[model samples]
Target: GDVCVNTLKQDWSPTHGIRHILMVIRCLLIEPFPESALNEEASRLLMEDFEEYARRAKLMTSIHAASASSASKKKATPLSVDVANHLVASSPKSSKKEK
Candidate 1:
């Protein structure tokens, strides 16, 4: 697959407040409310036994983290003014002929 490069200056920020994000994180890890579940099956399984859920979650998290870290290592260069200038400077200019 061809590596994709971002060609813009991005804000790349979350709209929601950090407190809300923190609260949700707490709900997920420390005190998961299974009855009011976002994922019913997983939540039910979690309610059955935390250790079981933790074992599966740990394995999945480790697998995901490994992939993500590897991908992050090959960080793509983003297009900028300097890059655009370099591209223009490098491209061959066509010669014009007058009749």
Candidate 2:
């Protein structure tokens, strides 16, 4: 899993993917973070171009939301208790001050 995602304070770059970029842009409209901007140019554009900002923001939110909602609705993989038990049983104990 990508741990850096949780720590991100800026929008996704184009290389990350179009949807990812949109999600970040949408979030910026919901709440701009100029103080912690990784892309000064983008922040400037968003602030100066209100109409475009709002338009893209609205479109992205709707498109991303539907896809994200459906993705979230899918059932998560169930944990295998038997495999877990076998793993624990097979693992050797740590070296300790034991007789």
Identify the leading candidate in terms of TM-score.
1
Clash number for each model: 0, 0
- Residue 8 of model 2 has an lDDT of 46
Residue 51 in model 1: lDDT = 88
State the displacement of the C-alpha of residue 2, model 1, in Å, after optimal TM-score superposition: 29
Candidate 2 colliding pairs, count: 0
lDDT of 1 by residue, 47-90 (tens): 89788888988887886665766878995644322322332222
Worst 10 residues of 2 by lDDT: 83-92
Question: RMSD in angstroms, all models?
Answer: 14.9, 13.3
Which segments of candidate 2 are over 4 A away from where they belong? 1-31, 39-41, 67-72, 75-99
Segments of candidate 1 deviating more than 4 angstroms:
1-21, 24-28, 66-99
Per-prediction TM-score to the true structure, in the order listed? 0.40, 0.33
